[model samples]
Target: MGAPAAAPFPWREVMEFGLGRLGWPPDVFWTASPHEIIAASEAFRTAPAGEAPARGVLDALMRDHPDDSGEAAEA
Candidate 1:
């Protein structure tokens, strides 16, 4: 047989699994509003792998989510 069909990215399952590992209430995570989820995911993705802050990622995220005036507010 050729390469097996690639598995789909089970986003919900992955998010739940990660939250469970961190001792967070997985059910509560599932119930989060879309905006809240987006914000949280952006923060998580930008955070450094270790304790260090990922300033670059944070800056990029903020830059991307600028206000209607086309300028990002100071954090």
Candidate 2:
């Protein structure tokens, strides 16, 4: 067989997450890269009952792995 067919892009689902679930403005949604959106979407959809990270964990993570925007995407 030739190479397996490529997976379809999940455009509608991604748009709904950005525009509806996350309530990002149209301009923000349109401008966000796929990686940025995926990171935000994952952060928002994680189980609410999960134990919260200790204070400053997020800051340390950002300092260590800053995004292209110079900060982590706000979920």
Candidate 3:
């Protein structure tokens, strides 16, 4: 018989983080492994909130991704 499912995977907290807080498109979220999602969420939580990004970093971001609207885009 198959081993039982991992308990942590069923936890709603992880699902919400992967789907909601991360704001990943549904397909991307679903495609990511649970460990991948958790690591990203943890990194996001530990990161400093509002501080100026370096000029080069900012410039590169704008050049690579030119979107006018979206909260995530700001950071």
Error of 2 at 64 (Å): 19
Looking at model 2, which ten-residue stretch has the lowest summed lDDT?
66-75
Clashes in candidate 1: how many? 0
RMSD for each model, in Å, please? Answer: 8.2, 8.3, 7.6
lDDT of 1 by residue, 19-64 (tens): 7644458677767776876676677788666784479976787788
lDDT of 3 by residue, 15-39 (tens): 6877788888889988998689878
What local lDDT score does residue 72 receive in model 1, on the 0 to 100 scale? 56
Please list the residue runs of candidate 2 whose C-alpha ends up more than 4 Å from where it truly belongs after superposition: 47-75
TM-score for each predicted model, relative to the true structure: 0.38, 0.59, 0.49
lDDT at position 6, candidate 1: 92
Off by over 4 Å in 3: 1-10, 54-75
Q: What is the lDDT of residue 41 in candidate 2?
A: 75
Clashing residue pairs found in predicted model 3: none
Q: lDDT for model 1, on a 0 to 1 scale?
A: 0.70
lDDT of 1 at 13: 61
How does model 2 fare in lDDT? 0.84
**What is the clash count for each candidate, in the order shown?**
0, 0, 0
